[model samples]
Target chain A: MQDVHTIGKYADFAVGDIRTFAEACGVTLSVTLLSLLIGTVIGIIFGLIRCSKNKLIRFLPLIIMEPLRNSPLVVQLFLVYYGLPVMAGILLKDYTAAIITLSLNTAAFFGVLVHNSILAIPVSQWEAGYALGHGKFSTFINVIARQALRLLIPQAITLYIGQLQCSSIVSLISLRDITRVGQLLSVRTMRPFAVWGIVFGLYYLVSFPLARLADYLAKRIDYTY
Target chain B: MAMIEVKNVTKQFGDLTVLDNFSVDFDHSGVTVLIGPSGTGKSTLLRCINGLEKIDEGDILVDGLSVNNKKNLKQIRKTCGMVFQQTVIFPHMNVLDNLTMSPIKLLRMSKAEAEDKARYYLDKVGLASKEKSRHNELSGGEQQRIAIARALMMSPEALLLDEITSALDPEMTREVLNILVNLAKEGVCMLCVTHEMSFAKEVASRILFMEGGKLVCDVSKDDFFGSVREENERINKFLSFIGE
Candidate 1:
């Protein structure tokens, strides 16, 4: 019998592999950006609701937010991807499913950040606005929101970076993100170590610049009174 | 009618009563300085007058409009311009914008009209050149001055000052107090809460001394610093303790 343990020579990474990875990067970027855009808008609305003076209105977002925040991302992705089709007969594309899951997850975390940021401002600020003859809505828009935005920026950017990494989970749902491409490439080339190392570097490449931008913004927006 | 009337008002934080059946009437003019030990509800009274704190039982009326009625709040707040102990100028805005925002937005003044008024008040506050400056760039005194100017933009019926100079240094306090004295001389209605005895003497038309959420003494300026101080041991002790 011929020796069954003989290993085949591994294929070298080529220019074509770079093109494949680039396309995968595009998917990851789009998913992250789209989710961020949608997430932030929803998050702000949820935050305003969370900050409501009425006790009933304040807890309304928690119905949706709690599950998204408490559960595993993988489980959320699976539910949106597989469970939705079975339970609701809503046949969403894999990309759509990934975006929805990530957006909701991001919204949950971002909403909390926004609520906390608004609360962090001194009540004197609101009193000052009101005393100046502004109604509650005007005070919130003119005074509270402006101040809260400064507090929200650096933290929100950090959250965005986290969401970008979280986008990696979409690969499990067969969304062909960088991680999925890496897995495929590693199998094809028999070079798991090299493939994963490059994948890790790609994520850092995308996230490092954003982290720097957040730091710069944090410093720039600081008030010194 | 009184400028502000706190009628049978009671306020509490949980079980601790801050203001119990507190009733007072502020005249439409003159500076009335509220002096008290901390936690005596002087600030809370000011807050209640402007509809900042809701009274548990009874009514606060500003310009004859009841604070208990939600519809009256906007007018009440507009009439009572409050400056807090901690100077709070809207950050991230230029001094001009800070002064002009409320006038243009709430009062429906034209932008040009608002700017002109802002420039006038900026000059009055000795901050004409600081119009383009942000709140963070100003000294604490300048910020408080700007806060006063912001309140002035509304042409309020009364300016409710809650220890406006307490956060400032001696020099800064003098600068702020000088502005207050000028405003008082010009006959602007003010209800001030302060520990600055000299400022109170110079600017207060009437002095209100509060203790345990009740007004212990309400008298003319000279009477408060002279006979009222001599007669009321509690007032005398408070004045001594605060180094008045």
Candidate 2:
């Protein structure tokens, strides 16, 4: 009886009514993927820069990472969205701002992860590669990177999942993400439990497969000996 | 010119002086064993030749070029190949690649030229067919033979053997020694720093005895263990302490 509403709302929502749900899914996935690509590029660049012999190049990450980690992403998103328009005289979309904030902030995130992964390699491996007459950069790319990749994968997966979950909070600026769509439907239909049930189930559908895929890939990784 | 000249070379790590004003010349085309107790700077001396460890005092000339000077270190390294005790043969590469790397990289030989040269050393070490095998596929002696071949691929004028046989079993040691004998016969000037007294005697044209950090006595194998040679008395005392 508490679930009853008007005839139009009594029936469950149409499949195409889920277009907003589709848009939320597509938007969040697209943003996270772009963020990951950009974040990885930034991280690798700075990570090697961190290992550079030149003091100036090594200190570049210090300038980039400090403010990135200090401020909240919410505030970062707002600053980029508002400040860029004022300075450049060009209006930016919400998704563009979200990707930039996520990419720059997670640059430091992946940078630290990459540094620790590189240092984890044994000194003998370095000696062996050097003995083969590889210069430092060549040795890093050919030998060290291949070894470090095995360790970097799990941390990257964790970052991606976190990014996916964090995408929900981005709807605070009226972005129409999954959670926002669910909230809108609940208010319109006045059926909070059923509406949120559909929302929560959709998220599980997205997240559970990714977690399983990561687990499956983890099992396939060959670190033996 | 001396194949290798080490003059008053000293290496100090903080307060611990590993090699104290050590000077030696490697000129002979045969094994010259450096027999001493552990931590007696045998490996330190070998590393100095390969330009891996820089000496704090004094200079090293490899083939008459100063290894102490950074400019000539690479040139010196290309001419003097070193084989470590734990001579891992690049587990990721096949034996052929392991052998060919130095020739290609340091000697500037083309890949085809390097591989062709690698095959010669491979055959010399009796590993012609095993060239295509991954490093882990070989036995310990086989792996060491591959490592030796890898070192030789540089076509080095001199070789530094640092306790290379100490890790192997007796059978493996014999196999490695046979290869070294062949190398010595080819007139490759060698500075072999090893603890195997018997191998030292069999292969060495000369022997240098060290106690602590000093080369107390240098003698030929004929007089070394046959009759006690002239010593500083400290050498005799230290030799007895080690029960050698």
Candidate 3:
């Protein structure tokens, strides 16, 4: 039929522009990786602060996390990308804006994950460490943290995949990520279906391997005790 | 100085006073068993001596270091190795690592030296072959024995055991108690909170009975198992209740 021929022709057009898509995929990956690294560091610092015994110190993380978590990522992107230049007279490049917004967003969620993971361990473990003459800091790093890693691995993978998929939103800031590249190609060829399908496949290509790595790690640390 | 001195200590959990004006002194080396009805503050006394629980009044001294001072806590804890009823071996580590980690990190012992001591204690507890086993891989009795070895690796002056055999089956209890008996004969200073009357009779040099946060009787084991039971109706009733 004519529809089948039209689909084949659009698919050929999409395949011909694979190099540009590949470059954009590279951009997406780099941005996600950078943000993930920075976000994890920020998240752990805030999570430890959140677990503080003092009331004032424990409240610190919530000041940043509440707004970032409650607001949509798109709004956050717009606020940083568009609002900063006008209000503060400080302009950021599109990539900088994307990375800042994405990292803060990831930090907000990952902070809570770290807090819950640390809390999931029993107080008895801390006591055992202390009974053996370890101080509070030593107990946390040597005893509590190792056990918490088991609780963290599965949830951290889910978060990583989420951040990866969420990075597609960077295209709205004109960062030329894979989604942006897909947008331009679909507009030019008038082939939304074929172009979007390829984008979906590319995202899957990155995510599947990460999921497998998580599986391997989870099994390695898993034990009945 | 006594190995451990509890000088008129009081401890409270919210409104409920667990230990009130309780005092005792442990000599440098002997087995002293604390026996009483449940919730009579025997375990609280052990915890206070180890600096696990803070006392509301008075103080505890371990190896002449006051538990009241923050600076003394680390040294005090190092001198008093505590084993809990729940068998808290670090699950993330194998038995050898669990035994060796504290000595290497805290005492700054070389790994070779720490491992050497760990093997000696592991052999003493009859768990020499379990060095490579994970905590979860061991049975309840084996885990408790490993816990004892872990405590011994630090070369503590005294061991504080709080209801250690309370959670085990009779067979497992026998296994752990056998190790404790051996440790007793070896002249390890031990302050044990337990309900195993026969085990207490066999190993206890002194017996301290408590009730309602007060020391009811402190007697030598023979006197406690003999005359004190006949003299104190409350102690006699408690002994009968526990099927002793």
lDDT (Cα, tens digit) per residue for candidate 1, span B15-70: 98999888888989899999899999999998888888888988987878999898
Candidate 2, residue B237: Cα displacement in angstroms equals: 4.9
- Give the candidate order by descending DockQ: 3, 1, 2
Report the Cα lDDT for candidate 2.
0.77
DockQ of each: 0.61, 0.28, 0.68
Greater-TM-score candidate between 1 and 2: 1
Evaluate model 1: give its lDDT: 0.90
* Model 1 segments more than 4 A misplaced: A1-18
Number of the predicted model whose DockQ against the real structure is largest: 3
Worst 10 residues of 2 chain B by lDDT: B226-235
Ranking by lDDT: 3, 1, 2
lDDT by residue for model 2 (B148-238), tens = 8887877677778888888889899989989998888787777888766667666788888776677766888777765654344665665
Chain A TM-score of prediction number 2 = 0.84
Candidate 3 clashing pairs, residues 3+ apart or interchain? none
Q: How badly does each model clash, as a count of residue pairs?
A: 0, 0, 0
**TM-score comparison, 2 vs 3, better candidate:** 3
